[model samples]
Target: MDVRAAACRVEAPASRPLDGTVVRASGDSVAVRVAASRLRALGCAIRTGGAPLPPDAPAGLLRVERAPWISGGHALPECRIGWSGPVAVPMAGERDVQAACGIMHVHGRATGGPRALRVDYASVCAGVLAAQAVTAGMLALLRGGTAVRAATSVAQAAALALTQYVAVATTDPGSGSSRPEPGAERTPPFRSAGGVRFEIETFRAESWLRFWTGLGAERSAIAAGWPPFQQRFATATCTLPPGLQAVAAAWDYPAVRRAAQAAGVGIVAVSDAGTPLPPPPASPWRLRPLPTAQATEEAPAPDGRPRTGDGPLAGIRVVESANRVQGPLSGHVLGLLGADVVRLEPPGGDPMRGVPPMAGEVSARFLALNRGKGAVEADLKSRAGRETALRLAASSDVFLQNWAPGRAARFALDAADLVAVQPRLVYAYAGGWAEVLPAPQPMGTDYLVQAHTGVAALLSPPGRPPAPTLMTITDVLGALISAEGVVAGLLGAGRTGAGVRVETALADAGRLLRDTHEVGDRTADATAPVVSDLAAMAADPAYAALFETDGAAVYSRAPWTFTRPSDHRREEP
Candidate 1:
């Protein structure tokens, strides 16, 4: 699921809680922890022991003088809310309190399940706030008038709690209404999930606009005013490869576009969305589209010729945790195009660093890709390795990793965790899903996608064996598209303040590339055996996979012989 989109529904698996980032206890008396600073900020006083309490509650205390009994499908007596006291619980009495405490469904408890209650962040934050209240207030009253100030503080805290609790209860899951609990140590989602905590500094609306205006004006002046601030931005973009960007593009373009522009750079950074749209005509400056976090200079510069650089992307830094072919070479390409690319390898070094042709100097894969790059080794699964990855992710503008799904998460290198630390970071992923989504083939790969999507099939035939052209040209084509998406996302990030998540599967890319022909029409000519009557008749027989005469060649098929060969081949199967 998308990271940002998760706001409306922080979806997670039934087996795990907190989206696999954290877990929760399944016991009845779930333990909760609240922060002291946050409670004070909410205007509540510490009244008693920092007891573990549930979320979605308000001020007040009642001594439990009786044993528990069943009522309203529950085993606890109830207390319904009555008078609105400044320092009283919203739903008082033991009965109602017990019910609300357990079944309130405060944050759309149905969004998830037992896992929800377990790692459920609500119980934690709300519990913490309540703990502070009990301690501050109860302590003050029992400690005698010596702690009157604490009682007043508790009242103040209760007021804040009322507003916040009401906000939580009434606010729709989809609406991003209230900000995080004010003065929170970290954002709510982060606090709930216990991931990275980003320090935030607020900006007044007018002041924020002024900063952008000043920055835009400065950039416009720097460019010598050829393209106005708006004009340059209007065309600025980043290109992404087949990766995460593909998934992101499935969203509303306007929202994505707006999100990009807000990122402040000319491009947006997202996982590569494999689909490539035709680009706008070239101007003095070119815009790389998102999928690359913050658009990078894929093409050297606008100098009409590639120049050795000290320019923006000239020495920019990128840390790649990629492996084998696509992922590693992607970073290599960035370095060749002039960004500083650092390759993270396993203890044995990148597999590519030894892909045959070893001259003890240049490995085959490394020769073609890893030029002008450096390497380091780490076991991403270990604590030390993850720490290294974190350090690199924090410092780099782009993080490239090509592992199977769920692999990165185990290492905590998933999009959510990384973006929280650095929003400008562009993440790239390349994988294939034959089972998850429908595809022409049951197994997805460059060769299979091309073959099943008609690229290879078009070039091969029934009577003849399937064969792909040398050099994996089809894969390269998809890779190029993937690379472009990466750049586009980065550009979007440069323009917008938010980062994006993108994905491109081999199966999806191959099908997209083959969409040029009319689909679902039997008569439409789609290269080779699929061609229409006239085109098929005129096509080269042997060359086009049609039955041919005995000559050293007329490539066009003899329809008569072709029928027999095609049938015979099918019969043999």
Candidate 2:
């Protein structure tokens, strides 16, 4: 869920993302051509191989076209959005239009049609978009207005020679490309909830009862037959919150739940997100970033080369069945920390292989999130792919995949299927549609989810037109979140001899993150500059009067714990 888009929304100073509906294609390329008015309103810009490309047909481009809207009184081969400020792509032409698009080029090797090449083409489109968004901030090269855009792709955009891109990969099952209203706070949140719970299926949640398995059954025999079964605590200790104990002692489930909800607390009654989860009064566990030791890096080695560390995860092994950014990148991060992450790609070298690339030896599109990891190609659709994945899972402590919803099950990568074979294994995922595990055919990605979840709306604040950020913000965030579950699940399985399966839907993370009021669609943006932005603006005015054209001076007392360098820019990093 893209929660950021939920907080604030204002009329577009310009309009864009003009209902660029995608249609069933014949083969390779899809086109995007919008009206000059709508395109200009959105402040939309298209760049190919680096410089600006005309919407009609940029030179050196393999394919280019526009989309048509029979309902909105427009028609074309593909669709394009006009320009607008940051956050949210306002649609035009049709009141509701949803299209999934991609590009295809005629290289004389055409073996399929548009729908057939959809996955491959879509991957390329997403890769390019992700790449551009990574380095989208160069827009500030415009003299004075500076926007700090940060993420993994700056290197890739240059490689691809493209500037910006967007995709509407998915829509709610019942939704029909309905654009957000003018005054609505950012986009509507695809997932929204507060005080949800996740209860582990163990003695910890056994109410007042305790499970003393085997030699540890200190109190189990006596408690097993106790008249008050829930209160039986023989071997294992039972812990509960002070508030919950009083309520439970009085047999008041409703009261306890009410109090917990009022306190903004999550209760886990069952492991399922849809179940009536009520946490058994245990204090929340410490939440933190899974420890990471730099996997690879440039350092002051004797030869000034990259270095590797034999950190805590030196021998840990993982298999990645993830595509694009969300899932595979997590493997990259883990690989950086000394984990042996084996990324499994389906035949065509992972959809990202052809997305785009940066200059130099490496392809830009494939470079952003895969600095450290091994690649293994397999076809789940073949006799070999399924066997390879299963074999890999058997030996892996963790398996991660983000192939939409239903796709995983079709490939037999779902948590239940994998856990049955590898009980102590951890399964991590990043996806949408609010399902922990679903069929994979669902069209889902950062763009559409950002729209549906309202995250795009949040990047831009009040009185500002929403902008679809170039960053796969939610994907990155979801990676981190999923990593936590993976680590914890692994730890639990190790400690309890149980490889607990863990699931994290994009929608679930979105709702959990939306606990604050500043989310997209939930709150109107305050339309004020942040403190840092304000401070930078203020500091600039003062600095201009004191600095010379060829000289620089930063006024400040030396830190008590440090000494100033001879030259500000001379310090070695």
Reference-based lDDT, residue 458, model 1: 35
lDDT of 1 by residue, 309-384 (tens): 4212443466777653455545554553345678888888865554433424444234444545777788888999
Query: lDDT for every model?
Result: 0.33, 0.33
| Residue 351 displacement in candidate 2 (angstroms) | 3.7
Encode model 2's per-residue lDDT on 1-573: one tens digit a residue: 111121012111101221232221111122121122112222233322333433422111211122221112111212112111111222111110111111111100111221111111122222223222211211111111122222211111111111111111110111111232233222111111232221111122333233212112224332432321222111011222223222233423344444334433222221221222122111011211122211111111122113333422345577888865567655654554345788888776765554422223333334445545678899987768888888888777678887755677788767667765565566666555444223331245444444434443443445643333323445554554455445444433332334455555544433333322221122222122212111132134422221111111111110001111223121111
Look at candidate 2 and tell me the lDDT of residue 333.
Answer: 49
**How many residue pairs collide in each prediction?**
106, 79
**Residue 543 CA displacement from its true place in model 2, Å:** 22
Query: In model 2, how many backbone clashes occur?
Result: 79
User: Least accurate stretch of 10 residues (summed lDDT) in model 1?
Assistant: 556-565
Query: What TM-score would each prediction reach against the true structure?
Result: 0.36, 0.38
lDDT of 2 at 324: 58
| Candidate 2 Cα errors over 4 Å, as ranges | 1-309, 359-361, 435-442, 465-467, 517-573
Best by TM-score: 2
